[model samples]
Target: MSNPAPAEAPTGAGTAPVPHRDTEEPAFPAAADRSQWRYRPRRAFWRSRVVRAVAVVTVLAICALFILGLVREQTGTEGFLVGLGLAVLPVPLLMAAFRWLDRVEPGPWKNLLFAFAWGAFAAALVAILANSFAVRWIATATADPDSADTLGATVIAPVVEESAKAAAILLLFLFRRKHFGGLVDGVVIAGFTATGFAFTENILYLGNAFGEDQEFGSTGLGSVTAATFFVRVVMSPFAHPLFTVLTGIGFGFAALAPRGKRLRRVLLPLAGLLLAMGLHAAWNGSATFGGPLAFYAVYGALMVPAFGLLTWLAVWSRQRELRTISGELPAYAAAGWLSPAEPTALSSMRARQVARAFAARTYGPAAARAVGEYESFATTLAFLRDRARRGTAGPDFPAREQELLHHLWQRREVASPALTYAARATGRVWAPPQYLDYDGYNPYRR
Candidate 1:
């Protein structure tokens, strides 16, 4: 979805600020007429110092519930160990996958878990309740026509299960709209929710497979179970992510899309959801057919394309920042706040990384980190500029937004012990000498 329009200034407050069009001028924070503001585990609690306490408690409670279930079942040694193994292996991988794709501003760990926990708890509960009845009703109506178990598996699970899982994305939109900055952010959030759902769902499937194996003898089910696991968990873990990302995209569009473009906001995410459902349905259909042709058709026609499209979109979204920097740095350099060579160096992603690494080399680890932060903030500003160009904003209306964002860069630059401030008395050697002069400071004579 698109970004929103710039806020209009009050009648007495002079002209409203216009967000800039496509030129790559660094959006220095112009002014804020107004200011605004996983999963893992049992072990996920320990990943960070701050959240560790709550995470630990949450994990223990989950573990206790599982342990109690085992105790009540009076699971034999083999059964219990099988259940435990089935449960634990996926947890680390699920968490690691979330961590892997979460390169964007690392989001609220609590929110990640909220998505995950919702899937694990609410989705399952609701699916069981709703589908239980639907299955029974359908069976009676059709005299086992729909087959209750099949209905639960095919129909109820996708809708109720997906909606409950997607509720996490909705919650993120409701509470932390700012976090849902763009489509990619939406993708990440969607992805986490999916990961959470898949993690929990896999446990049942995998656990059942194990339980069945013990009760009925292997009968080659280990291979069948492993194959399903590979397809669902390994091949394209994006299945759940794909579904919930639609909600995330909707939320992002709602917060950011231009004033009159609300229709697009509604439509785009719905389209994404439709696409997701189609993929889910196709996969189900193919699996239902259960032959080599079905396998090849599902993988070739549906799964691969979905995976490729999302991958392309993610990369395309990421490249905009680089392109924007390439476009805007000249304007900043002309303003004398950015040096000539520096702008070129920071324009490309590779170059920006090099520049960041260069700062690290010259200044040290702290400077490197500073450069990284500065680049991130700068890249985001460029993205906003692009959004504004597409009429996401009113006009070049957000002069203050530019100024505040620039102020962040300024602080980041200051944090970089290696590189000196650009708009200072001293000048770089290779560039033509320039001077900084504003209302208070004058470097030119009348």
Candidate 2:
């Protein structure tokens, strides 16, 4: 019996029209015979997208400018310049590390950029203002400045800062829910937010240190600037990211929960946020509660171990994503939506790399790009299907699945042969079971 055909794309006010197909064609039509599907989003859709884009950009830009002015006012021009230079050193490295972790099912750069900008400007601005106000209010109430400072750092700062950073994750989780799939996505987005926050924090600290050093006629290695750099930049660059990632993990878990399980969805993120706050408070109180020894003890006993564990969890989650792709795509393969070998090739990072390289070598950069897009769409499709099976998929699942299939179909000519070649080259080729019907019963459904 011939394999069952995949669902046709649904047409609507904003969606593209379904392409015509010959009734006599096979379930998986020949590459040349498959009609190319074009997505022509309606003018209203384009207008709304552009308007939202502009609004977000404008808000971020305004926040950035205000924060820049505030920092400059506090730190002299020269100090700001020095701080900026030093503060930027670890940013690219941190971003690269997070992006690398997200490689399996890479998110759009726009999400990452939004996370970073939100943390660096919007969140930072909120933290600084709210923290200062809280400290002053406590100082006035208690008539003890030092104690107010301590409480602000340990209690007030953690709550405010973590909440501010979490707003970015929360917004994305609600609005860009489709992209916020699982734990790794959470970790990556949280890491980017924390990295950006740390970047701005470092600049302020370093700039103030530089100003102090200038006032005291100190320079070189023995200066306040050097000490600040060594402590904040060299020693604890990952501190903020580690704290924020806990919150991200919480949101990630919540994302995986079925919509009907409302309590699980709410409690998971709250728990994550609480954990993040506790850790942040402990780290901040270290200096006040003890001294340098206490700081080192916390770093070694808590921070380092926490970081390592999260790192392992993130990596394991990425591997599980690949496994999910490998497992879930076979049903589609058996139904002729995908080539028999495509799932195996797409699941292996090495095979994927080889496929892209082969495409570029044979058909140039455009073909390579097509293959990359095809891979992304296929990976997303697998995740979407997995969510559907788990009863966690959103109302848009059918439309989204059809859109992904259309994109995959468009690029199959460039992607399929290269994937097949890479599968054989990498020794990962597999023959999907010929008679499996997903609609009736799927062994791989779980």
Candidate 3:
């Protein structure tokens, strides 16, 4: 080699291989492109065969209980049918509504289903058993016939019943912190669980209404169902969700808290749970003590404001995420990793949504998915790099992060633009060339 460089091999007829030209890296590496946002779920989650099987059994058991309640009802087929219809009617919309409110990455279907199932099965059974036993025991012990009903109203109903509902949200948090994401997501998950519980519980009451009808005819049942439905579903479908959301908030905090501060994490969640319990108890007390009309006033006066505050907090968190992403991506652009065009496109929520739509139009849903995935990785990398620069991330972290960034960048270029090209070929509108290009030069230039 020292004797004349061993006659250096020729490059493309007197040209050298362009640096960064290996954009399509070996294996569609996860680092080369940061514009894509991957929805790839994390592996080794709590969901497993056992969890699935158990969840299936739990749902079946709930069905069986509902059937038994139906059989005992004097209204027979009509009552059962009505109950079933009512129970299922709001499910899809309710689910969609909650999902819309949730901005953080959604959790697995099974995890959500399980949380709801816990409410329908374990929570329901435990609440009934605990309440009935406690009520009877209170009556016997206190030797006042009114004691059981009094305690049930003042203590047992509020404490045990709400605790049972809160337990569903708690277990979801314990089993799956990554799914918790943040406060908005917490509210959505808890809301669904609460909805499930409310639906099942409604059937019981509806069945009772039907039975009362059997004794008093359709008029009686219709009156009961109408009045109850208007009060429960129409007026305040939010009660259970509001109560359970507190636990969800606690769960969100627990997931977000740093490790090693065990006391702080535990205390925060405890405080949230206490808040949920207090609100739940007060609602139940007001509704029970004041009758339906009084309950209406209390519900409007108190619950509406509380819920409004939660909604505002959710919007605030969303804005914070937008700001965080906006601030972080510019540094990545200055680095060689991202083209100037990309950070602008991704950090703006509107731009991001349009990009996704464009990807989908060009490459179909699959392309859109890849784009989203790449972006998510890019975001994580940006955060990692920032931490490293701040001395928060450890030494050598930047090197490792760069490796990942390279892979994602390559993947983004391939999957992402391929979609754009595909869209053009299919006669779909693609992003304007000027908009897609960067600074009158290709950022991917050598």
Candidate 4:
């Protein structure tokens, strides 16, 4: 028999009263019940307000310095402006692609913002300085500046740049642990970080290329600037993001690793980083082996296949996430916390979109936002329950699960009917029969 939970002592002004057993528990405790009153949350170092403020200030300072350095190094303010404008062209497209991949359980905007900032600012700055120094040192030792530049690009640059980009993923995995769940999340975060890094690097290269064009009196389509833009922008926008995504995938596996598998958790991300660095090195070194034709051959043969494979992997992972939601949320539905058709609706991206649109149409944009929040919370709740079932849940699992349930309950009046309608409208076979009249079922009308 399990031990009874400790009783709380009663209070009075004159004397101590008799203690009474508090024999209560949540309907789904998720794990064995413990005296929750004694469970205080652990305070982490980064949670401190002062630490957070200092970290923000430090990152801002780094970004400022990097921007200033880029402007100074590029020369000719006109070229810098042109490069800045041109470099930004691919960013939104890349971001949209990653965001689409993460639609099943979109991560927090703050995490994505941090990844971008860290890549564009901190990572880029470190790469630039470290690569410059390393290349110079190699030139001095080898006494062949041309060969040194090749070495810098193929060897030093890849390691420096990929490691710098991976730092953003590492930080998120460590600090924003909740949001760094599974493969899609890892790929999305890494892709955004790499995109930002590429954006800054593109500005530098394009600006320098433009400066070279101005030196040679070349203009228009035949110029070095045009070639750089075509190569970096048009031909291979996904180059940097593709390389860094390996590292992110590694971190993703690490995140999904069961607790206590310390070796797997540590080694997987490292292996991913090494693979990223190797791929980046191969891409850089390609040009050295032969002419542009050779580089293109490697690109078509290796890079294209790798990209296609990773894309498939990311899509497959998203499908798996949807299946997990479909499989897990039915328990909550049975518990009456969610509608019978809600799990099926939540699993379909098309249904989710329809639900949000329906919510907006019925009760304005605020209702749509509530519906979106409900979806996120419900998805999270499903994942949490899945984790609990697998015995990998942390101490706060019950609290977090309850919190998500509470959010869903608050928004259910609007979200439920919308989702139910969505399931029916989308022609999902599992859609509950009663939900066909969802419009007439006013849940809030007590």
Top candidate when judged by lDDT against the true structure: 2
The 10-residue segment of model 4 with minimum total lDDT is 12-21
What value does the lDDT take at residue 329 in candidate 2? 84
Off by over 4 Å in 1: 1-117, 219-225, 243-256, 289-293, 328-330, 341-343, 388-446
Model 2 lDDT-worst window of ten: 10-19
> What is the TM-score of candidate 4?
0.87
Estimate the lDDT of model 3.
Answer: 0.61
lDDT of 2 by residue, 1-446 (tens): 35434443332212222223333333443333223332333457546767889999999999999887888889889889999999999999999999999999999999999999999999999998899999999999999999999999999999999999999999999988879999999999999999999998888999999999999999999999999999999988999999999999999999988777899999999999999999999999997798999999999999999999999999999999999999888776765567778999999999999989988988999999999999999999889778877677655656566667666877888898788778877878542344664334222222
Q: Which ten residues in a row are the worst by lDDT in model 3?
A: 1-10
Error of 1 at 305 (Å): 2.1
Query: Candidate 4, residues 1-446: lDDT per residue as tens digits?
Result: 23222222212111111112122322332332333432345457888646885887687577758665765566568788888899999999999999999999889887887788888888888888898899899999999999899889999999999999999899889878878778998999999999989988888888888888889999999999999999999989999999999999999999888776889999999999999999999998888867798899989999999999999999999999999999888877765677788999999999999999988988999999999999998999777666655545565664565556556767888999888878878888443354343447532332
- As for TM-score, the candidate ahead, 2 or 4, is 2
The model with the greatest TM-score is 2
- Mind sharing the TM-score for model 2? 0.88
Order of the predicted models by lDDT, top scorer first? 2, 4, 3, 1
